[model samples]
Target chain A: MSGGVLYRPGDSPVHRIPPQVKLLAAFAAVLGVVATPREAFWAFGIDLFVVLAVWSVAGVPVGWFARRAVIEAPFVLLAVVLPFVSGGPRVDVLGVAVSQDGLLAGWNILAKGTLGVLIALTLAATTQPRDLVLGLQRLRAPAWFVTIATLMLRYVDVIAGELRRTRIARISRGDDPRFLWQAGAVARGAGTLFLRSYERGERVHRAMLARGWAGHMPAGPAAPVGALRWVAGGSPALVIATAWAVAAWPV
Target chain B: MTASVAMHLSDGVLDASTSVLFGAVAVAWLAVAAARGRIDVDDRTAPLAGLLAAFLFAMQLLNFPVLPGVSGHLYGGALAAILLGPWVGALCLSVVVVIQALLFADGGLTALGANMTNMALLGTAVGFAVALAARGLARRSRAGLLAVAFLAGLVSTVAASAGFVVEYAIGGQADVSLGGLAGVVIGVHAVIGIGEGVITALAVGAIVRVRPDLIYLVRTSETRELVAA
Candidate 1:
């Protein structure tokens, strides 16, 4: 189990924007992409441009973004299946009739899904995990939710390291996870790992209480978001909304 | 097997109305879970819940081979519910889902609500209930416990798939008919469900053998029976 995060450390302007604002901006951009008509291909182009502009500003490599965006491969597989199975007026392509509506639907899924993913990737690349939790806290999310999220971010890597060790130990003992017959042993290893994690949690809780931990996680220093940060953080969403409004306007 | 559950519904897959409806339902479920004190954690339970979220995240990364050229990973809803109880299980899974979407880009941001509802809310609730019912029917023998755990995993995956079908029926963007889509989705998921069941059973069985005290559902039920006696 790798760290399972995509955050890249940088001091670019995009990285300086507060995590909450970037979160909101990402949300707004996704809404814009989803709301745009599929026929408005130019709107999708504008959305991509916005994403690229952020990528460039953040100094994130396009190859890096592309590599991470492969997580959307499953959705792409679903999109490829849509054109054949979907019912619509038929269009001839390479002597085969396919649903015209399905093609549009497939394109719709591919374009919008990719855009949503790109925006999210930008957010992840620019925001640190701790800052993200802090951002949630500042946004007035529930205290318990923030605390759990904070602890989760803090310990995810630790548990992932433990998992790797467990896998290695299993392999050294002749257990192979690749064979279906070995699934029982693999799952037992997972069970042992869970029990160990449970005990570690208990011990950590005790240590925290011994050092003086109240019911709530203590608040960190207040860092106010300036208007300039909002403007910079929100530009991608602004571009996307403008593109949608323009595309939707009657000639 | 290489196949895993559709972790998240992507944008444009469903109509706006359908997304909003499912999103609202997910939010309502979260509120209910919180109101029921399921998300609440004391000092002792808080660390456990957090570590459980991390553990789930790690486990999902480890996919086990099921069929040739296909693999499956633990959704872990049944395992979590058995160990932590349903409410905390739901919360922990929700946290993992959120982090996956945000950090790993494994799920769509807009479809977060639908994903959470299907995986976290429905999976944990249905899985836990099925486990309890199966346990009751099996008379709680050692083998019976393992069998129920397997059954719980199977039912949870099927239930989550059913949830997707319902959402697709309501707000599907593609032109495919409901029956046709449901048939394929449910059929493929049934196989995945078996993998889920096997892994969940093994995990539960191992824990039960070593430290029965850590199994929350078992502990609570035994205490209830003691009170009745």
Candidate 2:
């Protein structure tokens, strides 16, 4: 499902880095960004610069990341309204009175939200989905949890396709799922969809049993990554850490 | 249209300490839920949990218009909790939320723990609690069952919404008006909760008709009491 759409095929240094290292680095970078105090705008700037530079190095297009970043729109709305509703010391900007604290909070949300989404998109863009499963297993994630995630990644697209067909069938029957009156049909559709999906699961289990499938999928522990790759791959987190420390020690 | 997963908080909205604190809570409960689900039905848990997670992912994509220009989809917690026990339901929803956050970017990665806590753990627990409380009425008739499901959906949704507010109050960096924020958010969700209730009722009703045994709450109870079936 995610084979073509979310993940892009690339051979950059970022892509070559093991998925486990990249996942840890992305997570740590986000922690650093979030932990950096809201007053430290310059530190946030350096965090953004480091993220963008990596995206460039990984050959991820700015337009691609920007388009996918549309998911953050709702958070942006919340951030924008904060300045208006916030009660604090007033500051006049653009000929309107706005709360200075609210303005800082708004910037905080926007900057950190952008950085978090971009960092995740980079991992998704660089690593294949299957590789992510490997990363999880290597990270000592529970086998059952990884098993569920793997099956979900496998089946989500098929189910979405089924949903598309179901929607089309509704439309063909002169049912517009868009109207509130048609919600009954939509719910029933969801109900039957559940049965279909459940039966599909049952069948899959039966097939596995018939094939003498073991209770678990074969997932071997991956070879350990090297120290140099750890430091190099973790550079994003390192940069944000330095910025955070610089901001912190001054206080 | 908001994916059920969209109920999540965005990154950096909560301070790092709050995020980490909630993260620990999420991981702790998730581990317990996984362990419990595994002990119940050893072999089928994987396929059931996996496909159920997929089912939820697809269900969230089916958004029905709630307003003139607004649409909302099933969070699917009540329905899932009613079908599978809370253990399986929580695990399934957690998987969906993680995938949505990681692969789709529908939710924030950094706030993954917080999202899992509210959307998956709290919602499923609340849903099942309501279902258990109304067990007698639900067993009597289909109408009663639907009503119970509706109530489950409404209360669970409000509970999850309240969760976000609590976290925001504690960890929010900006000194925004908490009262106003809570009102707007809870008020909108109250209306959306009605939609959540109705949709949940209808869906559960359909499942009851086709596969009565699949309803976990109704099943493990006094089988002789299931007059609705």
Candidate 3:
């Protein structure tokens, strides 16, 4: 639950936008970013600007976002290795000849990847988990998929809590997870936790049936987004997408 | 032992066509899985599968230290497939991947297809098949089951790395040679696979000791016996 990076309650304009529109807008922005040519460096810059604007408006601290975005560290390592290993026309930089095309490729990964992650972060920071499930349903995503997502969200916190408790119990019983021999204990704990969760799922399912739950999950009471809200929600993505399309066009 | 968790392919790493192609294939697989109704609300399987997804999500967050400053998390595709069968396992992993991308920003949205293909499709499918084959050859003894689980994890990680090489060959943004790239990727992943194998084997072994009937692989064996009868 501590890792609930998906949503933070807020009253910003971005937060007020309907979840479906936000979802669509986020998807559109990502498509625009991915579709843009890597050579269009200016396009990426503008994309970054748009993302930053959203961040500022949302009032999320730069540090908060930056810390979570550090998940990209591994990819950054791979990107750094690209220039030396990848072959192409070489250029001298800092007394070393590196592949020009590979340098561009690495920049492409870093720039576009950062923007994509930021946009996704914006979406997550605004929308609640429950709203996201409802948004998917409203967007005509498969009913079963939505149902499973809803159920999974409900129990993810519970299972995570159970994991923490089990870890504490193990530690209290002289089990050290850091030791190699304790690997078996840790894994066995995971298995035991999973089995308990599975049994709980069975009981939960039976309870749902007892409470008259049918195959279809009942829709939430949130109203669908109106056309005005759609335009408002989609405007940022539209602006970014147009910039991408223009930059991607042949000269 | 440095156990590197499976890395998410970032955006711009693959050409648009390659990403789209993989994305389409992944969606089709999901459709097939859905149509098969393997994860449908059957009063038992659906809730169990949903909980499995949540449990995997939580477990993935736990990074155990393997060496000095190097830690590894459970990939869990093999473990999921062994417990829930392939279709349900793939679906569960897919759910976890989607949530990670949408909620946590852990993986790129455009690269979701590649991630799912590597972790969900190839990892689970290859791991499950290899485990089943090994079980058949080893007479399904408890020790054999654990060994097979280990092999499944080891092989699946390498197989997913191979899949990455193929994808890179098709639409690699870098000008790196396929042979060199594949060598590096596979070699590194093979070592990481040892950790994957150990975790998967011990986890599966633990369940076998307590509730063998709950395991999908064990259930399949019982069904085979019933059909023979």
Candidate 4:
């Protein structure tokens, strides 16, 4: 079962910045990186450095962050093989036919994706989950979208825990999930889970009405965000500027 | 099918009108989910929605290699439908896609509607239907039920991918052969479908044992059966 690593309270400058600033800056940085032309290799490298600097200010443990960031490994793996796939005039690399265009495309993806993931990781590691949702809501993200996200985050663990218990029950009953031929049991398990989750949503909705819920969800007190507060709190704009300059530099 | 299948299509591939059309559909679906019955927002539902969105987001980030060259990511509609009802599942997955598009740029903003249709509406609707049919035939047999779930998940993914190919044919930016490219994309997805099916089934099976009432699709079955009896 996949679990979320929520933000723990800390005195770090990164933790003190309002969620909105982090959200905007991180998104802006990602956009900047992705929009960078194919020739901007240096710019991508500098973006990486800026992201790392954010993690440092956030007081995130490098080891723990690295482990958590491993979630991006699959995407990274895909990027690794990209240069070899799209067919073109092949360049000899260790006696292998690798497409030069594919390599460039792969590099582009790897840089942007890696930068995006890191920015996200830094944001998640430093900010509380609720704050992130709240920030999104404040930014005019749709109410329905925000509300649904809030609920999903809350109940995922409860449902996941239940799933684990059920799996154990099935295993104890001599169900060998490992056997591909015995896939029927696995299918049933999924169907059964669906039924349970559906019913739970109904039940949860009833409970809300019983407690006097209105059509729209109410937001918390708006937090005042000052420019200086954000600049010091988040990674500086100069870092991004430097990265942009590098990305624009000659190949 | 290559393992690194990009769920997000290029902007030029889908015409502007098509994107807006799908976007409207996605919005309408969410509106229906919001307007249905009790407008009361439950504490549990909201939190669960967020977490599930996160789970889906994270899982999609971890696109596993299904075979030698192809990779697949968690599309999440079928899985969400199993855990949350089709209406809510559709809403959740679409939101996830929107978030990815806006925040990550993994999916283009212009084609957001099409992505939602492929990953959320079509994926969840078809997956739920297959699961329902499977459940109907295998109501009495545990093994039969599992088979149905497996097939449902597998078929749903292929159907979703096929929908992409169709959309591409309609709004193709390149000179690639429509029928041939569509076939290739769908064929590879068929194999990737197994992994999606297994992961979805495994997740579903785990949840059902603890709180059968928590599952959206299965809950319908038990209730309907009771009503019939």
Please report the candidate that would top DockQ against the real structure.
1
Error of 3 at B24 (Å): 1.2
Give the DockQ-based CAPRI class for model 4: incorrect
Error in Å for residue A104 of model 1 = 0.9
- Which residues of candidate 1, in runs, are more than 4 Å off? A248-251, B1-5, B221-229
lDDT of 1 by residue, B1-229 (tens): 2333355777778766677777788778777776565345455555667878878877887878875676767888778877777888888888888877888776777788888988898888998999877667534687988888888888888888888888878877778878988888888777778888888889988988987777776766666354223
Scoring the B chain of model 3 against the true B chain gives a TM-score of: 0.91
lDDT by residue (A1-251, candidate 2, tens digit) is 55334888989999999888988898898888888888888898898899889988999889999998887888898789889889889999999999999999999999898888888888888888888877877777776778788888888888878878887998898976556656788888888888888888888878877987566767776677899999999998899989988987864
Candidate 4 stretches with Cα past 4 Å from truth are: A6-9, A95-97, A181-183, A230-242, A245-251, B1-76, B79-87, B95-118, B125-152, B159-185, B194-229
Which of the two, 1 or 2, has more DockQ? 1
Question: What is residue A91's positional error in candidate 2, in angstroms?
Answer: 1.5
Over B7-125, each residue of candidate 2 has an lDDT whose tens digit, in order, gives 87778899998999989999999889988877234767787778888889878866788866778888877877888889889998988888777777666777888899888998899
Clashing pairs for model 3 are A6-A124
Please compute and give the TM-score of the first chain of candidate 3 against the native first chain.
Answer: 0.94
Give the alpha carbon lDDT tens digit for every residue of A210-251 in model 3. 988766577768775688989989988998899889987898
Total backbone collisions for each predicted model: 6, 0, 1, 49
Rank candidates, DockQ, best first. 1, 2, 3, 4
Runs in model 2 lying further than 4 Å from the true structure:
A3-5, B1-6, B39-41, B221-229
TM-score of each: 0.94, 0.94, 0.94, 0.69
Candidate 2: give the clashing pairs: none
TM-score for predicted model 4 compared with the true structure = 0.69
Q: Pick the candidate with the highest lDDT.
A: 2
Docking quality tier of candidate 1? medium
